[model samples]
Target: MQYFTICAMEDTDLSSDSDLDALINCTLLYAATKFKRKKRIWKSSYLRKRETHGEFRLTSEFSDDQFTNYFRMNRMQFEEVHNTIQNKIYHEGSRAHKEITTKEKLAVFLRYLASGNSYKSIGYSYRLGDRTVSKIVNEVSAAIWECLQQTFLPDPTEELWKQIAKEFEQRWQFPHCVGSIDGKHIVVKKPAKSGSSYFNYKHTCSIVLMATVDANYKFITVDIGSMGRFSDGNIFSSSILYKKIQNKTLKLPEPDMISGGEKELPYVFVGDEAFPLLENLMRPYPKRKVTANYENKVFNYRLSRARQTVECAFGILAGRFHVFRKPFEIKLASVDNVVKAACVLHNYLRMTSTATNVEDIADEELLSDQLTSIRYNNSRNSRNAFLVRENYTHYFNTTGAVQWQRDSILRGKY
Candidate 1:
């Protein structure tokens, strides 16, 4: 049998364990110590150093070059924002160290978010250590969240509620609707040795992000960090919405004609079956009739229209940042920060964008008409007749009361 030797072109006598160890050490040394030859000049310099020293010493020189190069690049970008971040970290608003600026650190963090890359990848791009990259990402994200919350989410005031109600009417054609409520599961890989707390009905570990969005797809309320094992209904029941409902402190806008001055009247919000049925909270009927009438159809239509904003809010966050589009692999504890940051950023962008009115999205009437047409068309075909028939029957049977309520409000009978 023939054996290969390190740097060997042919079989040799130097095939001992020490020889093999030396070869392995030399390979590691080369990878760690070699200068990243950016140009012919750099390559020549590195080659000259290698010739001057033995292989091991040459490797050490290259390692130092690599380390210094990485440190220098990282410091350049970090220095730009060092002071701003130091002030934030110190909370004294003092002049930051001239060495680095917070804006630079923030820019690096945003670059990570926009790219959805790993810390190591980000470090390589910024020429920093992975640990430093991780720290910057977390700190900058916290700062961004703080900045956004201060600017975007105000304390619940009557004026804010009134504005929200007006936006609802104008954007969704849903009168007196305070907000659209929904819950979404953000999938995550199951952690080792952890309990089954994160495992949901979807047979995967996840966390729930429940939100109340206004008609224009702006978040009015956000609750994160719910275990995925709980049902959406269960999560909602445990949320601040439930508390607000119980305490009756959520003093929303009174129902009033969109054409007239706000007459203090009762209005309702739309949710799905996951929420409890309440006079102030409207939900789609669990079932429909085969011969659904205009009222039943209208109830389902209006409910869907009001509920869509929450879906759209979730869609925008997930779509714009693909990081949450798939299962995450981090620790469960960090899920809340990710969700909160996403929500805060969503609101921040909405506030800054000129398209805040949501005129760019499809109108509710057009969407409703298309959906209804599809249902009617599908019901006529026997292939989908049973399901369609069930849907039709369910609406008339369960949604009649809601339709009447909406009509009564419209007619000033309530």
Candidate 2:
């Protein structure tokens, strides 16, 4: 379609300077009709019937399994998310068009995250424009984070830390372990002129998602959106969580005795080799060191079991949401909030879900090395750090020893 702006002008010849000036100065006719460039058919037949086939239709008409398959959550879970954020995402309608319902906006947002499809493709399925779909994604993602973070993913309290430690001991037999910390690379399109800032060693543009997870695969605290070019240790060291822990401002519980141990030991977080060894953080012994002795192998095995909580969390996240399975194809500005919203939603679904296995959003769908093996250059730490680790090592090989740990380590499981 073509467009023309029509106006009334004095009768004049193009050859004359006066006529040219008159043409340039002529006022646009107030009553003149201007043609606008628009699609000849604004809504196609398929588009008009989108309500019968789009996510709305699927979410409403599909059976429980089908519903979960499409949206990555059951209807009850989806409604919980909708009810929490509907008001925030809601907009008043004007004469031009009826406001998009919060439910529809959420459907659009979920389709984008659940499938990692392009906005244009999602818009096509929803009978909306690509720009509108993009807007909905950003708006709904913001609402998901702001409305849900406090309730679903609150910062850990001192009491909560103690509970986490107890659970870690009970569940994984790793006493005094508070939480598991790790980082995952969330790939994205490189921002314009960002240089190598977001370029990772894997040769992809990405951002880091650093999370501390509790025993039940729930995120206790999370920090994301750092450039992927940064190492895991650098991201951990620079994060506010690290700062708080180092300054003793996070109010971690005081040292306490384990079931069979006489000495009080500081509660600690479990991480892979990518993190520093500190009095309050335990990482695996180096491969060479672990091979040298039985005690080192036992400690590494115990810590690896405890640290897999975050790995399982990331696995379920990438499996159910699927957005993290590839580079996020949304706007760069929206990537952080999108990831934040997913983390918040993961917490919510975990609490609400009773579903099991591959079809379940809460299942521990552990990914292979792809999501778990991002490592950094190892650096040694303090003498006190070594002492703290040795205390745990001694406990694990002796009183903290489980029947299967030694066998598992001898089988080269660590």
Maximum-lDDT candidate = 2
TM-score of model 2 relative to the true fold? 0.88
140-243: candidate 1 lDDT, tens digit per residue: 66665665676675556667777777788776666567888777777877878858987877677877777788876778888777777775466776888767
TM-score of 1: 0.62
lDDT of 1 at 303: 65
lDDT of each: 0.56, 0.82
Q: How many residue pairs of model 1 clash at the backbone?
A: 22
TM-score of each prediction:
0.62, 0.88
lDDT of 2 by residue, 70-164 (tens): 88788888888899899899998666455678899998898888998888888877888889888999999999999999999987788989999
